[model samples]
Target: MSSPASSPSAPPDTGTRHITATILLACLGVFVSYLPVVGVSVALPVMQQALDASTEGLQWITDAFILPTAALLLTCGMVGDLYGRKKTYLAGLALFCLGCLVCLTAGSVVQVCVGQALTGIGTAALLPSTLALIGHVIPDPRKRARAIALWTAALGLGLSLGPVVNGVIVAHTSWRWIFLPSLVLAVLTAVLGAVVLTDSRAERERHLDIPGQLLAVVAITGLVYGVIEGGSSGWSSAQVVIAFVAAALGAAGFVVVELRSACPMLDMRLFKSSAFSGAALVMAVTLFAQVGLVFALSEYFGLVHHASTLDIGIRLIAINGFTVVLGPLVGRLMNRATPGLLLVTGLVIGGIGALLMNAFQAGTSTGEAALVIGVLGIGIALAMAPITTIAMDAVPHRLGGTAAAANSALRQIGSALGPAVFGVILTHRTLATLPGHLASSGLSPADQGQVSGLVSNVGIQAGAFLHLKTPASTGQAQAAYGASFTDALHTCALVGGIGMLVAAVIAVALIGIRPARSPQTAPEATAHPASAAS
Candidate 1:
């Protein structure tokens, strides 16, 4: 990405001070981008009441952000390369700050959804651009690995603290105020990046691929939409069926479009390298288990155990906090050992931790929950940094932005899929089994039917019964709910655990230890005859 004038034959390494300043802005950009993700879920109830939102309205509040981020990723990476990296970085920050402002002042749910879309766009633009910036500034592969690890840690920090921060905001002030801190940080980072950061892009020529962009949008949007709706409205619903069809067609169409286009947005050949493909798949499935389980566990603690938002956030800190704590150590390990070995080891440990979560119940002690979740967090921390390093290192350095975009898009898709997959499992399992639990509670048939109807009608929101204390009947209802929910939790854990183990096996087969070779080991040799996207 360096200009001929700026890049020397043996370019001296970037200054420590300069790299520090660059990472500060990059990390800040990443931090604020993720703050709203888990944070908003904590505030959904207040949002629902304030806006009088319907069930559909509540779902869109989260999807509004995810759809745009998933759809725009590759396009945003190309934009950074075609326009200027610094410009996209600044634009992304400005866009996020604007979205926060809009949401903070929103009076209706529609406005909030719109604002969320804007923020999602900003995230799409920011992710690859920031990672590409790291690639450009740091010439040494070893140094870049460390930088990317810190970047990953920043992302973890944002996610870990989001709920805690939002919980405090909701407890003390309005839920609307949750975006205030993010807005301030976005503006600050934008100013800092504008002042000190040097702009760069792909040294080789590239162009915007309109057809590819459009197809990517169609494919990703359809898939995410179908999954989200399929869970809520039932998989057999007409709209859900149409959405899946559109998604399949769009995905096929996208591959054809990219292959035929003169200027492809993403070079499909990158996946030919075992390293890149393996890392990308690992990222998707890992997040699938991680984020998906978070959604289920949050509901478990909130509804079944009657934990407040703050308490739930506190409990989750054991998982996310360990990720941040282990970041630096993981980076050093990757530098010293075979990254693929670490990757497989982490996934295996994570799989074990996920399987152990089946033991959790409404009465499970916080200490017991923490011990299991902490193991999973450690595995995530160990594996996350190495995946980025392996993927980034597998391709030519020039393709860093595009590679980051592709990997990130998969991660987002996994995240979006996580909630949908687990939510469906939890909802269907809970509803299907609730009646049986009620019937066994020694209640008369009429009373059993009445309580069962109330819980069944609410679907998974039967967690809404967490606080009901009306009478003996209510106590019976709560006990039945706890049993049903624990069953569902066990089911979710079994599915997630199996998926994690399967992904680990795939990682072992596809990725190998990096061999010692020439300094020009990757990029130059990795490129094919039609490597140029333009």
Candidate 2:
């Protein structure tokens, strides 16, 4: 039996063309799939009014995309291994295009949700297949690391650029234009992928792990639904409780199924590597922290700050604008520092940024907020590329899809969970703070209730700004509301700070810093082809 690495492809020297082409092709999928999350947040009020959507229906529009993406990621990874990365990615692009068309024409909330779900599935396919293809096409460790860094940077670019594009489109045209750009981009990507991407499939023939896949889908959906809904349902509500229980059972079943399956959706044995485990945890937690910040930032800028939808998008973009510029620079730096060192340093910087925002008062100027956001962006750039490199490099060639899929899954889950969990914090804090303000000198109970309700409702709007109403009675409400928002910010910052500290500790203690060029430690380093050899 041939080693998986040696089965078909040329050695590392010959794979660069295929790798570059595939990465370019993969960028389209990343852009289309993730752009909606940010863009739609900016467009939610438009969507709500256009469709006359209920609050629950509006939430579903987002959840429809997230749940399916998280659930199907692992399965799609397996599919890439069983079939071929090129095949899977092409199919994904096709599916994504179809979903965008559906969204463009949707007259009802259900149709939008359906469209989102389809897009989510397509995204699942695109993500893992791209990573797995990288593993096949980039055979040299150094080149592969650089390639992975670029891949991650591309993903970050997609995420960062999504809202900016959406803002531009929505400002000039209708919300439907959001789908239009992606539709065109998707078709273009499909054509590019067809032309440039080579077919690369697994060497070992293995059946799909149906049981494991099913259980995983169940587990992830349950967990995501529970977390997302927990805020509205009240954590102690029967529905929330049931969702939690179902998630627990499903997750437990998935473990058992994977253990017994001949070809597992996830190989548990990989966790035996402390480096891999620590890296994975950092990816998940950092995403949790970062996404939470993004979520809150969207709300604060649009609703609380009373910025225009386009202004909100532009402002947020300005905050992270530096990151898009700095990411490649960091990628070059990774050639010098160990992944562990970069990861810890990035997390520390990002945590500080978050803490700064948490310390924010309603009195904070937009410039101050934007500066803090820029810091967070830099921190994300510093860590994300290196951490992804470490995790992907630790695993073997055959399981590349699985490892990538696992990483994507955790990241998505963290993103999903962050908003839901933090939204609750923001909500409670706002509500508690508003009542004292509502008790002002002249206001009746009925008017106070109305103002309080509106404040809460507005706070939930992403990319919208909020303002507190001064109570009729004295200047009571303004002071209290300020104090409350400040308290919430502090609490959020502290939580984020703790998470970063933990990540740093894990990084320093569990993840050893070896120089990136440690030829003595990694045999592959010495095996690189010299220019003469090439």
Candidate 3:
């Protein structure tokens, strides 16, 4: 917390060391922020076992981290613009590391969620700072594009590595141990950032938009809470209706607050540019499909296939591994290919990949599943860097921090909604179809009653693979559970697939208009130093 850094972008010189350090730390910062997303995803079944999490509770684990990250990203970007990027980076790392420590020893699911929220806050701070620092440190468009690609690749690498790391940790010891490596990485990055990073900020003055921020949080939180709870308690329930109403008011209020504010954290007029708005929507949709599929598939592999933690992680590699391998290349390709072209193409391919998952069954082979997953990953890799590139390019360099934060925030919002929305689909689908699946399994009358009661009380997660020991009598029950769950998985996959295709159509219509393409043409913000924390 120092005075406003209305100074120029930092590391004043483009020396090899400065550029190298900035890129490295930026990559690592994103790496640390995303490590938990899929890493914890692959461990969901194990976590369910260890913590006794019900279906909704499991979704909360992921959303707990994502909600805060989504809610605070814009505000945190303001912090970087007002304070220093390095300060925000360091602060973010410290909070993330502390959250890891809390998770490492957490005994209950709620405690783990509390820890995740802390990491989410840290993630919110880290994301915009890292990207903005890169923008500042690398002034050349080509070099910045490459750096952003590499930054995105690092995110892919983190996601790719999470399952492997978590798998090994869970294989050897407790699921809690999964947080240890991330904790270590956060500490190392913070220390290095403290030494190597230089301070930078928005060239223009910025202030906190506390009212807007609060409304954003309320809108996002209420929306997610309603969707998730609506699935369990009837969608028509009083609680769900109230939550939806609150969310609508909150969203409308945020827009009003931003419109009237002297110093808005995010200028409402920015969306007037099609590229900026399209990228935001696409970012949310892409993550919504990708993350939601992972949540559903993780359960499928673990529960239906009876895969071990290591097995589950290994199975998921193709989904993120392709992204890790292709990210830098995609960056290069952007120089030649139009971002809109690449973006639309990726969405189509990813949509196809998601639709293919409808073929996945309890007995599907690993090789069979790998093909679809690989396609999905490749599609995602192609789209990921472009979203960042288009969003950054659409805005002036001075607004890089705002653009990055907005992009990252939308991403997390989609991520939070993914589990909430997908989990609801899976829950309702499984429950609706479970009776037929169970009856077909030829379960004894007594067993049927008991199993139905268990699902009723504890949710569908009561039938985890670990709980379905394979005795002659129990074999029928396991098969029934598998059939029901896979049916749900297919439904989830279809939802994701259709979502991707729709996003593709959206990309075609937008991501091209750039009315305020240049800094000189763009409208300027009002000057107001008045501030408040979100």
Candidate 4:
């Protein structure tokens, strides 16, 4: 279907006011969408208790949102380009608001999962459209870079504030109230978007590759499901094996379909550019490490330190606060410094922070944790915007939506994998060490068996351990559980640090020193003419 143009009553000329309005709306849209990504982490323990959710169930609560986001992003980006960016963007906001309402009223974990899925779908639409609109509105390369950096800053702010805001809510009220801010922001963004943003789409008649889209979604869903379930269900279980096999087939089918399609959703040739591939990879790995670190640390603060929700948020400020200050600064410096250099430097710094976290023990001080987390915050701020700039710059201006979507989808994929992988590592390590601890505790076999059953699931293990009220053995149990939890945290940090180091290496190897050309100088598509076709 062809997209309609901007309102006929609107002015013919694109004014500075329109540009500013568009940027603001786009930034708010991005910020709102990202709030739930990490904010929900702070509320997971509360949500688990309220919903009586298992470890896997809690994982699904987060995965349900991330899975669809990762899967549908590329397809939705294409949809926005083919239909209309503004229209898609507004629709996304409305859907996001609806999702928030669902979550706000949710009575069960299943309902929350459904709500999160809807939000993810909305985000899949919102993210690419916002970036695409920015590309459409700002034609100048230098100016566009700055605008994108601002957009990235908005995203960083959302990520940084999610935990803090949600923590405060959980502290003062209930976890359900966490959705209120997102709902309010989504509505505001939608209203502003409809009034300010000009409708724009690719002026070409490209067919949507439905088969490729379906296959992509199926592949990502199956893969993420397998990873998430692998921790609870044995990795060798039939369900897990079947999921992996199906994912493999779906991915292979998607490749075949895309290669043969006349109009592909994602052009495989984009990966041919080392710069593009590297930037995308760096984006993925950065989130993988960052998200995993956050997940581990949030639990550490709550379970290990016995901190309240608000206190946990306050402690976490060391990790994400710098993004608020450094995001725009990095954007401003993009023209002066190579993005590759920034990406590498940031990754190295972040990796060091992750490595530092490996020293954490049951008795580690809060100040030490804050110092390490502060280093991580600086690294994330320096790297996040530059990688995005590099990725979008590498693609054709006309394909901005697709490029943005692909980059975002990959990052979401990494985000989904991070928690699952870390959770698995933590659960397995904890479980393995628990038996040794129990044996040494001199507990009777029956009591040991009961204890094992109680802590069988990683989701409730820490809380259960902390709240142990047995008069005879409470102290010994606490010490054993503390040691085991600390060991798991150390292992997770090591893995995260190694991942960041790998990303740094990739950034150094593939990212270039040069800046991309402006849209005016970018090549126009002659193969795919800008003509109206059914």
Question: Where does model 2 exceed 4 Å of error?
Answer: 1-16, 48-59, 318-320, 440-446, 453-490, 517-534
- Displacement of residue 193 (Cα, Å) in model 4 is 1.1
Give the CA lDDT, 0 to 100, for residue 19 in model 2: 57
lDDT of 4 by residue, 153-244 (tens): 88878888888888888888989999999999888778777776778877555668899989998798888889888988899999999999
Candidate 4 C-alpha RMSD relative to the actual structure: 3.5
Worst 10 residues of 4 by lDDT: 525-534
Better of 1 and 3 by TM-score: 3
lDDT of 2 at 49: 62
Query: Best by lDDT, which number?
Result: 3
Model 2 score (lDDT): 0.70
- Which has the better lDDT: candidate 2, or candidate 3? 3
Instruction: Give the count of colliding residue pairs in each prediction.
Output: 1, 15, 0, 0
For candidate 1, give the lDDT of residue 501.
Answer: 86
* Model 3 residue 519 lDDT score: 24
Best by TM-score: 3
Tens digits of per-residue lDDT, candidate 3, 1-534, equal 343333543334578898899999999999998898799988988989888888888999989999999999999998988888889999999999988998999999999999999999999999999999998877666677789999999998998899988999999999999999999999989999988888887766677899999999999999999999998898999999999999999999999999888878777767877778889999999999999999998888987887887888888887788778998788877776677788888889999999999998888999999898988988898888888888777666667788889899999999999999999988888888878888878777777777777776787877654243348647787778788889999999999999999998888888652222232332223121111211
Q: Estimate the TM-score for candidate 3.
A: 0.94
- Tens digits of per-residue lDDT, candidate 1, 162-265, equal 88988888788888998998898898889888898777767666789888888888787787778777877888999999989988988898899888876678
Between the candidate structures 3 and 4, which one is better when assessed by lDDT? 3
Better of 1 and 2 by lDDT: 1
